[model samples]
Target: MFLYTENFEGQKEMAMAGLSRALAEDRVDRDIIPLLEKINALDNYFTTSSCSGRISVMEMPHFGDKLNSVWLGKWHREVFIEEVFEAIGRHRSGQLWFLVRSPILHVAARTMDDAVKLLNLSIGLGFKYSSIKSVSHRKLLVEIRSTERMDVPLGEDGELWVSEEYIGRIVNLANAQVRRFKGKLKRLEDEIEVLEK
Candidate 1:
């Protein structure tokens, strides 16, 4: 058997410097900062990217055209039907979409073992889509993700495809998904220190 040794010194230094910049700029999301810090405090891990999750109404010229997507409203937590309606009222010349995304986190680990540990922890914590995203001499990345998502088409060209009552129904479902995933995120945050033990 071949022995594999990984040196994380260079990447760890870079990750710390980047974390410092993000902290100084207030670029990190407030709710997840404690988790980020906890992970970074471990010698074997660092976070490259993360989103606590969100629900939003957006207008775009076409599907998959995120470059031109305009956000009418976005919320990190569950939202009320009235709030989404207020956003829909702003829709003009584009496809209007109501989206719900689950929490996502990209973690860098010092070794394959480290990556696997985090990946399993995330899946156990309800991030069902957790996996090893990439592996190379320079990095081992574990992507922590969940299955809660929705991409419902609300309208196109400033017209509503569904009635206001229908919007209310979808909003309720989306909010429920939001609550579920936020709880998962919190559990992962609470349990991440287990990797260090």
Candidate 2:
């Protein structure tokens, strides 16, 4: 018999409620909604958090300083060069970076077996960074992620470092990454129903 974590049903309920709240607030990524819903519909899995990935221009005091970081501009879809320039224009202090991140999904599984199954599926679907995030009596968490990412330092303080042509080049690259991940997300959505079986 498969053993689930203690209060698994209760935790799933609470997580569903949180997802509902995020949806109502428009805080959930639009592209990831269908995938999250499908996972939540399954008996053994529920998404705790997800991002369909993003391209952004950000300002921070230093690298990895998320607490003080500010998004000068962010997009869930392909971005244009003009949009990037506008975001860079807003950067006044601290480090400026052009970033691209692949889709990420955090799922809570009912059992360790369920977690492993999902993790393997995710990795097979090109989420090479997928892994079992945590394991305990409380929950088995699986993190579905991809390796596509870029962190290019644009400038610091009020100075501009790169030329417009450089920005344009990165914009094209970021768009390509966005298309690649979106394709992966689509494939995952198509295959996720297999988990229900």
Model 1: per-residue Cα lDDT at residue 60: 97
Q: Per-residue lDDT tens digits of candidate 2, residues 1-197? A: 34467888999999999999999999999988999989999999999989999999999999999999999999999998999999999999999999999999999999888898899899999999999888888878999999999999999997989999998999999999999999999999999989867
Candidate 1, residues 5-79, lDDT tens digits: the string is 256777777778997898899877778788888898898898888888999999999999999899999998889
TM-score of 1: 0.93
Residue 194 deviation, candidate 1, in Å?
0.9
Where model 1 places Cα greater than 4 Å from the true spot, the runs are 1-7
- TM-scores across all candidates? 0.93, 0.97
Best by TM-score: 2
